[model samples]
Target: MAKLIFVNLPVADIAASTAFYEQIGATKNAMFSDATTSCMVFSDTIHFMLLSHERFRTFTSKAIVDARGMTEVLTCLSEDSRDEIDARIATAIAAGGREDTDAAQDYGFMYGRRLEDLDGHSIDLMWMDVEAAAKAMQPPAN
Candidate 1:
């Protein structure tokens, strides 16, 4: 079986979060979705488990920190191109998400933009020109 990664996030409103993810192109996997939880599939290998605060509490005894107050984890995903990154960010904002306070970054071969979901989870979208990036990192001949 192929290895898969599931990133679990605690959301205040399960339905709204699920819809937000869906609006941004993620497909809701009904196989694991219910009133308190949703399975948002980003790709074949990446899946997001959006769980309500109550459902999330069952998994851990620690208190859930509000994401809006501080940074916990910045989830970043690589994209095919800069346009793709921009499109996703625009979609997120249109669906009620907010752009990151910092400006988008351009590092010659890499470009990145960030957005926050309705629940304030930081989502970063990045794009890199693989060949250009590899060449840029090579040491110059003496």
Candidate 2:
């Protein structure tokens, strides 16, 4: 069986977090969901376990970082195009998430936009065109 990745995030409200993720095109996995947690599936291999604060605490001894004041981790999602990255950020804003950074990055080969979820988790929607990157890496014609 293929290994699956489960990213467990602490949220104040399970339902609200689940709804936010739903708007961003994730679907709930009813097979592994309940009142205390919701399994938000972004893809076949990637699953986000949105757990209530109390439930999340059980898994870690460290205090939960207050994301509003400091970043805990930056979760990045790759897209097929730069427009797709922008659209995802826009959708996140429309869904009540806020832009954590002022502008999208254009590094010649890749582009990205950052946003903070309702619970302040930092997420980056990015597009890295490998062909473009490879071209950029090539030495200029003499």
Candidate 3:
């Protein structure tokens, strides 16, 4: 069996978070979803476990960092094109998510935009030029 990856996030409201994820094209896994956690499937291998803050806290004794005004982590997904990136960002905004930054970055070959989820988790929608990235990784020309 293929290994599965699950990214868990703490949300204040499970229902609202589940709805927001659904709006962005993630499907819920009823088999693992309930009042505390909603298993949102992003792909065959990737899933997001949206857990209520209280439930999430039970996993660790450390305090949960408030993402609203701070950078906890930035989750980036690569897209095939800039248009696809834009559409994802648009859908996120339409679903009550906010833009994390106004700047659109264009690194000659790649372009990206960032948005914040309803819970203020940073997400980046990006289009990377594979060839360009490979070239950039090469040692600089002397």
Candidate 4:
């Protein structure tokens, strides 16, 4: 069986968060979704579980911090190209997300940009040429 990852997030509004993820290319998996929880699939193996604050509290005893006021978690995804990253960022912005253009990371062979969802969860979209990046990381000859 293929390995899979499920990223759980506490959202203020399940519907809004579901819509936001959909606008950014994730599809809601109805099988694992309900009124207070949603399963947003980014790929065959990558999924985001959006849970309401009340629903999320049942799973953990720790206090849920405000993502807007401070950094909680930074999620990064790979893109097919730099153009795709830009397109996704624009789409996210149009869907009520905010882009952190000042956080753009560019290293010639690799580039990335970040955006925050309605709840301020940061998602970074990146593109990289694997071969070029490996070459860039090689030690310089003496």
Candidate 5:
């Protein structure tokens, strides 16, 4: 089987968190889901495992950080285009997530935006056009 990535997150509300993810383009993978956990599939190889706080404790002894107060990680996903990234940000906000206060990043060849989910998990969305990036590196006419 191909290598797969499962991003595990501690969530206060499984239902709400699952809904939030679905709103932003994910499907529930029932094979790995239960009352206290949800396996949200972003694509063939990318998945998110949202576990209730109590359930998440089983995996670690360390206290779970309150994401709202601290940022332990910044999870990013690539989009096909800038428009797709923007649409997802809008969808996320409408579903109760908030946009990060950081200013938008535009490197001419790449663009990105960030947001915080209901559980305060930082999610960064970005798009990069490889051809454009290569072209941009060439010296301009003198």
Candidate 6:
């Protein structure tokens, strides 16, 4: 069976976060969604669980840090091309997210942008040419 990943995030507002994910092309899995929890499906194997502060607290004893002030997790998604990366960032910005243009990284074979969602969770959008990246990583012969 294929492995699947579900990222759980503590969100300030479930409705706003759900709309943000939906605007960026993720579909809501109604089977797992309710007033305090939303299942946002990015792909067949990738999913995000947006949980309210109270709901998230039930999963752990540690206090939930405010994502707006602290950097917790940096989630990244791969894009098909450099253009696609920029496009995705643009879409995210249009949906009330903000792109950290100063954090943009660009190499000849790779490009990436750091985007912050409404609740200040960071999401990185990246594109890379596998062949070029592999060549760049190879050590020179003696």
Tens digit of lDDT per residue, candidate 2, span 57-119? 999999998888888888887888888777877888899888886587899689988988889
Output candidate 6 Cα RMSD.
1.1
| Number of clashing residue pairs, candidate 4 | 0
Q: Considering every candidate listed, which one attains the maximal lDDT?
A: 5
Residue by residue across 34-131, what tens digits does model 1's lDDT show? 99999999999999999999999999999887888888898899899999999999999999999999899999799999999998999999999999
lDDT of 6 by residue, 1-142 (tens): 8999999999999999999999988999999999999999999999999999999999999988777788898898888998888888889999999986456899989998888888888888889999999999999989
Q: Compute each candidate's TM-score over C-alphas.
A: 0.96, 0.91, 0.90, 0.96, 0.93, 0.95
RMSD (Cα, Å) of model 1: 0.9
What lDDT does model 3 reach? 0.88
Candidate 4 lDDT: 0.94
- Give the residue spans of candidate 4 off by over 4 A: none
- Which parts of model 1 are misplaced by more than 4 Å? none
lDDT of 3 by residue, 24-82 (tens): 87899999999999999988988999999989989988888889977777777777899
Cα lDDT for residue 23, candidate 6:
91
Q: Which whole-number lDDT from 0 to 100 does residue 129 have in model 3?
A: 88
Q: By how many angstroms RMSD does model 5 differ from the true structure?
A: 2.0
Question: What TM-score would you give candidate 5 relative to the actual structure?
Answer: 0.93
Candidate 2, residue 139: Cα displacement in angstroms equals 5.8
lDDT tens per residue, model 5, 1-142: 9999999999999999999999999999999999999999999999999999999999999999999999989899999999999999999999999999998899979999998999999999999999998899899989
Instruction: Mark the regions of model 6 whose C-alpha exceeds 4 Å error after superposition.
Output: none
Cα lDDT for residue 101, model 5?
91
Whose lDDT is higher: candidate 4's or candidate 5's?
A: 5
Query: Rank by lDDT, descending?
Result: 5, 4, 1, 6, 3, 2
The per-prediction tally of clashing pairs is 0, 0, 0, 0, 0, 0
